[model samples]
Target: MIRDGERVTLGDTAVTAHATPGHTMGSMSWSWRACQAMTCKAIVFAASLNPVSSDGYRYTAAASRPIVAGFRHSYRVMQSLPCDLLITAHADQDGATDRFRTAPGACRALAASSRTKLAARLRADGPAR
Candidate 1:
């Protein structure tokens, strides 16, 4: 598995991993630079923001307070990135696919928006007491 902040190179491009353990403890987001002709853009493949749990998943348990905190931390990390393109684990999360074709820097906006939304969600749901 790739560790957080580790950089892996593929051809001339290098991808850096950012740990975003909300959906799962090992969830990660990757950031890299992509070049097309004369254009070079920073891209981030964002990890899922949705909180997921199976029948026995710890996240669903009353003791999973840390997991909820982790999600908040991940959202903060994502908001701090300097990415020109932001692609989420789910396409509909940020309208990334369509925005990628029409607008650059959409990812930045999406990141901020996601952070805001997540904060509100967490506030409403509250951390496990």
Candidate 2:
């Protein structure tokens, strides 16, 4: 298994792994630097941060405590990533397809968006146990 924070080498690129266990217990994110001629860009492939659950699953359930905590941690991890390009597991989740320019704050914005989604779900479904 690829452990969190481990760097895997691929050709001349080094992809660093990040554990972003929101969508699942073993969800992962990756970051790497890519260059073209002269300039290089920091790119991050963030994992799906959605607060999805199976039918009848409850975020407030005792067994879901770790999953809920994972969501929160995933948000923090996404926000802290330093990258010129941000790619999410779900293209629509972070607006990666419609972006025409690089936004330094994209990672932060993506994290905020995911956090908002979780908040909405928690409010609409169940606040707490």
Q: What is the TM-score of each candidate against the true structure?
A: 0.73, 0.89
Best by TM-score: 2
Q: Report the number of clashing residue pairs per model.
A: 0, 0
What are the per-residue Cα lDDT tens digits for candidate 1 across 26-76? 888998989999998888887777654554444434777667777777877
Q: Worst ten-residue run, lDDT, model 2?
A: 93-102
- The sequence of per-residue lDDT tens digits that candidate 2 reaches over residues 59-107 is 7778888988998988888878887998777756744665322688877
Cα-based lDDT for every prediction = 0.71, 0.82
lDDT (0-100) at residue 76 of candidate 2?
85
C-alpha-based local distance difference test score of model 1:
0.71
Off by over 4 Å in 2: 94-101
Candidate 1: residue 73 lDDT (0-100): 78
